[model samples]
Target: MKHGFKQRLFIVAGILLVVCAAVWLVISAISDNMRYFVSPSEIQAGIAPEGHTLRVGGLVVAGSVRRIAKGLTVRFEVTDNASTIPVVYTGILPDLFREGQGVVATGKLRADGIFVAGEVLAKHDENYMPREVQEALNKAEGAVDVGNAMRKSAGGSL
Candidate 1:
């Protein structure tokens, strides 16, 4: 009876070890696939990791969209009013993509400071903007307000 109990315990331990390893592998795979959202200002300040997939949200800079080939390859600039990042995408852009519209691009930042986008998403409705883009804009506006206040206190132009 003692030998039988020891064998059963060893079997259970082996099963538990396999289960734990499987769970760990699944969690690591999911985390590796996850992408983070960032603003153009954050990217410019070196807050976003290079070579890691990330999403960037901002308004499409006016007069910046240009097609480089007969295919769907295009390039443009996304800006948060304070900072701008150039993006290149090879896929067909959304129907709503246009100048001055809000956009989100998911991809990796290259060494040359340009975002190589895997997907480009544009605002679908005229009055709607991505939540990330809205938050970034608000932050930029607040910063501008603070700067103006500081200038006024220093006896500078409003």
Candidate 2:
């Protein structure tokens, strides 16, 4: 009976090891595919990963959108109002994409501080903005308010 118990223990340990290995593999795979969402201010603060793909959400700066190379490759600046990041996308933008609209671009940041976007997603409706973009804008506005309050307390002009 002791020998049988030892055999059962070994089997249980082996099963547990396999389960752990499988879980580890799944977690690693998911982590590798995960793309973090960040704002223009965060990008300006150097919070974005240099080479890893991530999502940036903010308003497309008015008059900053430009078409290059026959209008296929486009460049624009995305802003959280407090900060802006230049973005280059080499494909046709969404139909709703326009200046002063909310946009989320997925890509990696180039060494020259430009965001090379693989995909550009724009807000669908006039009243609808992406949640990430809205959150980023709100955070930037809050920062501006705090800055203004500090300046006022220090007797500085607005």
Best by TM-score: 1
How does candidate 2 score on lDDT? Answer: 0.83
* Candidate 1 positional error at 154, Å: 36
Give TM-scores for every candidate, taking all chains together and pairing residue i with residue i. Answer: 0.82, 0.75
- lDDT score at residue 29, model 1, on the 0-100 scale: 99
Write the residue-wise lDDT of candidate 1 on 1-158 in tens digits. 99999999999999999999999999999989999999999999999998899999877776789999698899999877789899999988999887776789999999899999999998787567677777887686443332332234334532
Residue 129 lDDT in candidate 1 = 69
Report lDDT (Cα) of residue 77, candidate 2.
91
What lDDT score goes with residue 15 in model 2? 100
Candidate 1: list runs displaced more than 4 Å. Answer: 141-158
